[model samples]
Target: MGFKLESREASMNGVALIDDEGRWTLLHTTGERPQASPQIVASNSPSRDGAFVPEVRQPLGAVDMVLRFHVSARGGAASDDPRYVRDVNLAELTRVMRLGRISTMGLVIGGVPCVQRCVVSTSSSGEELSENIVPAAFLVKLLDGFWSAPLGEDRVAGFLRAAEGGSGPVSPVWRIEGPCQGFRAVTVDGVVCEWAGRVDVGQAAIVSGWQSWTVPASLDEWWVHPSAVSTVNVSDSSPVLPDFSGSYAVDVFVDGVKQTLATTKVSAYCGQTFI
Candidate 1:
């Protein structure tokens, strides 16, 4: 009846399938399996010595999932015809697989409920006459690799507030929920950085979702230090300061509406030893 999968804590789980029109179907499944296959891209060039070495160009690719289920054929004694039950259930599955262009899939992995958008890549059904049941399988793919946080509306709002406060001493670290394009972090002093990293929530749904971003913590070599304090002394006497920290702002657009979080006071501290 609800919109999530039911499972025992710390054990393998099953998935609940929902159609585009919000219709739900709980599969009578024996096992649920999800696999991740990443594509490897490589290139090779001849060296001066004429030996060719392969160079990896692209490493990651889309993930594909295969779901298996066991269909039951049981009814009241009067209408308990095994073949009839199998036909009806098979037809129902066919309708779900065809009409549901984009659907919501729910499953639990390591006691965490994962929900995401998915489309059926392939599916098949076969009749097991001896067992008087039907066996069904589906291959689905995720559009992204992030999982939606299982937080309520109130909790989500609170999380956004804390993330805007930032994480590290120099720059603020922000935990962002996705189903959006991208995000930007800026400080009161005009320090800005664009986030472009991925977080692996899990493989239950196999799609991408929201991500967390920290300013100086995740800067690495990709980010260029702001011009204002690019030449500050950061030796033992003083540590290199993060360009953006307290009183910062995070901007993101969700469902065509721009959402912004502004924090009041953020502080940075330096550890020192007086000999």
Candidate 2:
């Protein structure tokens, strides 16, 4: 059978249950008609906050999710205390077929978990400003079947070797920060940076699978390809090399960004003296 996933909003204040195959069964507690407790709560598309409520898709057995709610302490009470407490015992409930395996589950407010019954005591008697102190909800997410690959020691050595002896205008700069995983490409300005093979291709996979990236050094005038090597004109009037007394300079590009490395000019000097 195909994997099933679904999410249902807890109605009023009740527990929403789901099975391994992703089916909904709501347990409602009527105020007066407790004997006629319905096995399946009425399906109503309640709007949550500003979003329409719908069944959420989830991976089975994942623990990255939780149930959510909105709740707070009611005002005008002698003490800061919640209007009512919603009881939930998942570990026990699941053992008794009351709850299903899901990634995460929690009652949360303002992105934080709301535990047990939110209570307002004498310590917060005059602090509340609202009549209805409904606390925010808990959300549950399941986390299972997640997989990741690890990097190898050889991969590090391979990358280091490549950086130490790479040929090009760009040099391998010692890593200062990172080359995170899932990064498919990198650009300096608008130009894509090409990977120079110093490390074995196997090592490259290690970096990719492990989420590490390499740092590169700047390159000066150097041979790129037979048709595209950078060059400097020594006899040109504009003096390519500014600062000191260097005669000529070559421009370099890394990942399409211009490099600041300087290259010495190779030109013949000529001057005529008058007697």
Best by TM-score: 1
Task: Give the TM-scores of the predictions, in the order they appear.
Answer: 0.42, 0.18
Q: Which candidate achieves the best lDDT against the true structure?
A: 1
- Per-model clash counts, in order, read 11, 65
- Evaluated against the true structure, the overall lDDT of model 1 is 0.36
Q: What lDDT is reached at residue 245 by model 2?
A: 27
Model 1 error, position 238 (Å): 29
Show where candidate 2 strays beyond 4 Å.
1-17, 20-91, 94-197, 201-204, 209-275
Q: Give the TM-score of candidate 1.
A: 0.42
True-structure RMSD, every candidate: 16.2, 26.1
Q: Report lDDT per candidate.
A: 0.36, 0.22
lDDT of 1 by residue, 1-275 (tens): 11233322211112234322222233534244344333443434343444332232122234566655455554425556767766666666656555336765555544445554667677777656344555567776754333332432111211233222222222222233433333343333332333343333220001111222223323332122332222122111111122233222333333334443343111221111000
Worst 10 residues of 1 by lDDT: 202-211
Error of 2 at 248 (Å): 44
